[model samples]
Target: MPQCREVPSRRRVPSTKITVPGPPADLVSRPRLLTVLDGASEAAMVFVGAPAGFGKTVLLAEWARSRDHEAVAWLSADAEDNDDRLFWSAVLEALGGCGRIPDGNPLRLLAVPDAPSTDLAFLGQVADALDELPEPVVLVLDGAQEITSPHPWQGLRALVRHQPAGLCLAVSSR
Candidate 1:
């Protein structure tokens, strides 16, 4: 039998200054860019795809800081996170960091090294929870190019496509 362990509850951590070197000077004043991107996200999906060193991450980070949203979850994707289970777990934890999980009960459908396929029903529960938010919730997936599998992408695409009205997604990839 699979060992059932509860996923750790995440808490809302105050945003810390992101220290990335050589951020463009002019990029800081572009409020219109953020406004447009935020508007775009409200209407449909917005993907920031660019090669490495294009300032995509910095731009999004700055924009997130400027927003008045209650919570913002940021996950820096690594190579190992390509695994669907690990990726989602990190995402869930990051969401927790943003105070998205209600009542401190985190539903765990995947365990490390188990590679169990994602359960859509559980995802539905998460989506429902996100929809109930009183204010907009922003989830930022940085370094998204690390995700190589189509399955996780498909799941993320579904989530983005069907995201609750109050939930917003911002993805950056090289």
Candidate 2:
């Protein structure tokens, strides 16, 4: 009889991506900046890249505030959560958070082998869900500069390219 060696167990820890931070209570409103963002809504991608203390969060939060009628999903990613699996996990979480993606949805079907085709299929499911919505959905990947890998960038590109109508991809990086 052959003896089997004991295999070590691996625990799946959830990603620590923070919730989108809110603007200060006393922060002043900027109507002009809001107007610019409203105008940019016609474009597919709205990227805000600037140095620290550039009011990126405040601006996005303001836009979110003004556009309360829209479906918005905000995700605050950190440097530590910069992996392919974690990146998609966070995206799913954020989308689910906004009620954009339903609970226990195509995410389960998307768990099949991680290939370009699977990745695309998963994104397609997301796009289909967004397409069914009566209002436009704005998915904000805030603090995205922390992720330096090309995988997330590629996925983001594919998502933006194939996103459903009335969906926007807003990336805020520093």
Candidate 3:
């Protein structure tokens, strides 16, 4: 019988790509700025306050592509999601797009009508989920300022102010 050599154990590695596309030539500078912000030790919330043609979304999409061990979620704010409940539901769904939503009841509350009052709870759940992740996540909210409703923005601000170590938020407005 031939003896088999013992193989070394290897650690399970997380995926490095998050499917974020790069920006066009016209929006190059913004990506660089985002890179700088991302590298900081402190948590950051980037508010891209500009008009529609300012290329905020393009820059963020590109910057997200270059990150290592990062997940990206894009939410296109629409009039239908004016309510905090609806907005968060959309946000969570977007996070799902990047494989960020873990399996649990934390998202179950989204089905409830009065979920907005529990915005902090949702934020906590999101933060906890993201904290368990080995990679960082970037959530891009395009047309964020259009939300108009105080509740959604309040929840968003709260999330930004107390973001998990592995999560970051980038909001763009016109």
Q: Which candidate should be chosen as best, given TM-score against the real structure?
A: 2
If scored against the real structure, what TM-score would every candidate get?
0.73, 0.76, 0.68
Model 3 agreement with the true structure over 1-174: per-residue lDDT tens digits? 999965322122122222344456555566467666576424557677777787776766666665542366777776755766667666666666665445552432233235543556656766677676666667777777667767777776676677677667777788
Cα lDDT, all candidates: 0.64, 0.67, 0.61
Cα deviation of 47, candidate 3, in Å: 2.0
Local accuracy of candidate 1 as per-residue lDDT tens digits, 1-174: 999977533332223311222346666556777887778767435678889987788878777677653366677776766667667667666666565445543332223233323556656666666776666667777888887887678777676667677577878898
Q: After superposition, how far is residue 42 of candidate 1 from its true place, in Å?
A: 1.6
Q: Model 2, residue 153: what's the lDDT?
A: 80
State residue 144's C-alpha deviation in candidate 2, in Å.
1.5
Higher-TM-score candidate of 1 and 2: 2
Model 2 per-residue lDDT tens digits across residues 30-136: 88988988888767788888898888888887787677623677777676445666667666666655654445545323442243333676667767766666666
Put the candidates in TM-score order, highest first: 2, 1, 3
Q: Between which residue pairs do clashes occur in model 3?
A: 22-62, 23-62
